[model samples]
Target: MSFKRVFKQFSGSTLPRFFGSDKEVDEFSQKYQYDPKEKLGEGQFAKVYKAYGKDDGLEYAVKVVDKRSLSNLDREGLKLEIQVLEEVDHPNIVKLHETFEMKGKIILVLELVKGGELFDRIVAKESYSERDAASVIQKVAAALKYCHERKIVHRDLKPENLLLVSETDDTSVKLADFGFAAFCHDELDDGCGTLVYVAPEILRGRKYRTSPDMWSLGVITYILLCGYPPFFDTDQEALSKKIIKGKYKFRQEDWQNISEDAKDFIRGLLKRDPEARMTAEDVLEHPWISNLAAVPDLPLSTMQKELREFLAKERMRKALGAVIAINRLRNTLNAFAFNDVDGDDDGDDDGEEGEEVREEDI
Candidate 1:
């Protein structure tokens, strides 16, 4: 697959009239006032702005997608994101208030999360601990459990994607960015995710499903406790090799004060064999999360410093060229075939089916 296809970054030739009939653009204009100057974030094909409801006067994040810039594949991916966002309803998940199909663009009205990303929030904390980390992971795992029960895989899970709903509410976590999410009706073939958090199965070009997401969560959980990724390398090849080998350690310097339960939790999720990996339900019931009250409150001062340094490097890397890295990895993988003899078992127990709720109800 091409880099754009694998990265799902919406880089391709323009496509006109992809949304069929245009819904009245005034539907959004009449209800919300969006100022382009109040831009919150931007991606390859979309820009999000801080908006205000005309009557309710509530703040919102309005994501504007330039449909004319998307290819057919990009359009399909956007539709899938919208569908998944519409179907999910959970306290820890970001809310989509409504959608508008304009003449040349599509707009999504989403809940405006005032708090920053996960690591940043923790770094600002006066005292960080395993208890605090568990609290954050519990929220993420709860959201994932809800999604997995519905056969929806987030595909991408990382510190940047985890958001705090309020600037003052540390516990108000929300899982944001469904751009790479999909319903796992069968084994998923696409290997679309950031380089660091991607599962080994995806890097090997193997068919996978929810277990990949669990692996991602495992990586995130490791970073949460230690303030650095379990696997790290500046070179893409070296990094992928480390991940594929599934060999990471809890270094003595950083892990000396950490609890065994937390380490065990990470091991369970980071298993190389998908069948041996822990499910989202298992995450919820793990002693680290289940017995959170008993978790040590020893301050992770060194961890906070490491987190700050990690965040700085992350920003620099993004500015320099995350897209370039993806292209390089894609080119490297094109020459090889990583077919496994094992059958296509997703290695997750299906949870009870939940009722599908519309955005309005959520």
Candidate 2:
């Protein structure tokens, strides 16, 4: 099926109440002059379209979000994202041009990044080296330093969130998505972020700060130099346990070609103690990142092939998880509707039971 059709069906199935009136949607379309033919991507809460401004004819990625589909926590997360995006100003970060609200939906006008994901670009290359990996990490570190200095913690940092400006522009790695970001002062005791990228401290249910992001960067750097993540597990519980223990290695087969300085850099960032982890500024000053020219060019065909397979499996896993989540949401909504129709007052018990399920699953 076409991406547009698939997204339409997914949105309709997952969020029936979020669909605005035809008149409201028409007004929004007229205001932005968005071409429905130019779909960029779709996510759990929004659909992105490649739009052109009528005033200047400049291209933009317009994200349409359904407020009615969001829970109270989800709404708060959106607000936090907007706040962070508005405050951040860095060359390596995606820009948010403007935002508008109509009916029960919010529209965000974002910078259109022509280049695809960073890892996908690397995998497409015929040859990848430690120097090439250093260049990417340097840019990512700069972006993280910029955000960290501003007291913003990007709670979620993964390869998929890193994008290049264009295929030819290797240096222009832009950090995208602030959906899970929050202020440094915010209490972050809840377990959040992608499973593999989550830090040891977070996995242990400890109150975390910005160091978790550094740990995630370490994981990305590890994959960049090699093909696969340092830690891997099919089961979530087992993965969390592994992460908490900080059990990872630079296997002889992979590390034989990789430099000691590179391994040291990863070690500093992936330290089990958040206090011991290196900051973004420290990463920028690391010898491996500061001196990239001396790094060796190694044949990474094996790594590339492994990365491609890992990414394919990860995509399937996420798709399955999304389907499961949608089904649960549908069941919850149906139960609420039934209760309302039957004039039932057992909502308190149902809500408590739902909370228990979330605690166990999450």
Candidate 3:
């Protein structure tokens, strides 16, 4: 499915502008260099490529957004994302080095993280344990705590957005993707975020703040300890109903060997009431996270097995999506050709999504 976001900009906003004549950087080609390497990733309105600074020679990821393609609200969302990235600096969060405003596009230079996604990395591990899961959550929770202190809420928190710094270092997980993030200064009721990880209050159309993010974190934690998601169904409505009801269970097969502290941690995060859900600060102090020694090192073969199946399905889904994108592009081209032949008015229709986008890629 296509990812969508909406942002309503107001006067007297706190975000800093990346464009305008006052800014020093206006030309992207003069500051950095790239090989036009095969596209690292893509999104609805942008494409990502590997680039390096001209002076420092350090590697970076450059996200190029076509201004002509963005709607008014999309541009506002992009501006907010840039402002939030500029406001925060943490080891576990992806860093935005600088930005450039070209003639028809805006370019954002970001930290180049080569490590794969969180679940993909975990499935490859020879041995996994509660301690390992705790380590991953600890870093994510710490990063969230940093953002929440500034009143920023990351509306989307899923395994795809969590990435390791390098293939060899699994402990150094970084939180990527801020497309749905927003400042939680007032009550929000926008229906955004991926379906499975979405919080109950959002689906119920209730006003909320940062609590939804914690619920997503809880779902990720559950997936990390087990292989599959807590809530699942063939139908979207059915799955959403389960999430709204907070309907989930820790099967004995997945939890028989898992520690009680770990289970308790999940329970704390998955609470139905937003107020009852654990905050990022509370998560940092939980025994499962604070007391690492208490966590077990037992091999999580069940998780690994389930993860393999889950990953396989994910691959298939992506492949199908790519095929669909290609077919749509072909159809659009064919339509243009027909219009050109018939000379039936000037046809100007460009489908929104152009590339196969991944969470960390953007």
Candidate 4:
């Protein structure tokens, strides 16, 4: 629920810092001018603003992270993201122009994507078709294939991370956000990623690789055709259990109008075994993706209805999760305070010893 919690769960060891060790803050400050009024968004660690290059007059999105606000782990994760972004170059993947450090803030200059999230465009459409979804998926697959070839795995691949180049360009879906991405030569054992989109192997705590990305793509594909995720539960643990078991159905009501070829493609990607799952290249070659024009345009009113309901429910779940996390934190703090008072009153030499005695007495 919390960004810090997500980072703690996913982040690995620190790599060499991406920026030059000897570069001074003033040097970067002199190279670019940021427009204070043109703000994009803010996260826990950083704020993104629209900026322009003084020399070339090119527009860019600059993410500014306050060094003082970040932990060592947070810094490591940010550096790793930058490292991954620097190596990747594809039309479907958001480009990183450059990175700089200035006055205790790490600034990442990224390509400015005008059009919003991929889901926003789909939701805005009056008549959605399998062919439309396939076209979008094709672009995403191309991006993934490029990354996989370079040994980079985007651990987080959901609709939210997929963005369009422009409102009119339905085919130009660019994959954004590399915070949870990793480069691996062998299987990785880290349990990380968003809950519903995560692969079965990762949920089971088994070693996994780029195959999980394909699994996430399948989930996205499922949602593209329908409105909701394949695996859904109000409870996180229950949802995780479903994912680990790979227990999901097409629900006759939802799939009755959808094409069989689309379903087969999804099944191939969502296979329980990573080895059995389709690779990015394989997905690009799948009939549904390779020949989108042939896919039927079945009415998706039912899917649209379900998606609206799912979005509402997802918002509620996130709100509930935040409240629960806050309450748990408050309770722990209260208990710690109570223990501190009891320990002080008991005339104990060691605070931990008195706390243990109080806990046992309770």
Q: Pick the candidate with the highest TM-score.
A: 1
Per-residue lDDT tens digits of candidate 1, residues 156-218? 788889999888887669999998999998988787888789887777777887988899999
TM-score of 3: 0.82
lDDT of 4 by residue, 109-174 (tens): 899898888877776767677788888899999999999999999998987789889878766889
Q: Which ten residues in a row have the lowest lDDT in candidate 1?
A: 350-359
Report the Cα lDDT for residue 278, model 4: 91
Structure candidate 2, residue pairs in collision: none
lDDT of each: 0.79, 0.74, 0.76, 0.74
Model 1 stretches with alpha carbons more than 4 Å out: 1-16, 19-23, 322-362
Each prediction's number of clashing residue pairs: 0, 0, 0, 0
Best by lDDT: 1
Evaluate residue 254 in candidate 4 and report its C-alpha lDDT on the 0 to 100 scale.
73
Q: Which residue runs of candidate 3 sit more than 4 Å off their true CA positions?
A: 1-27, 318-362
Across 252-351, the per-residue lDDT of candidate 3 in tens digits comes to: 6677998989988888887767887899999999999999888898889889988778777667756766222222322333333223222321211110
- Lowest lDDT sum, 10 consecutive residues, model 2, at 351-360
Better of 1 and 3 by TM-score: 1
Q: Output the better candidate (2/4) by TM-score.
A: 4
Clash number for candidate 2: 0
TM-score of each: 0.86, 0.80, 0.82, 0.81
Per-residue CA lDDT of candidate 2, range 47-98, in tens?
9999987778788899989787898667666766887888888889999887
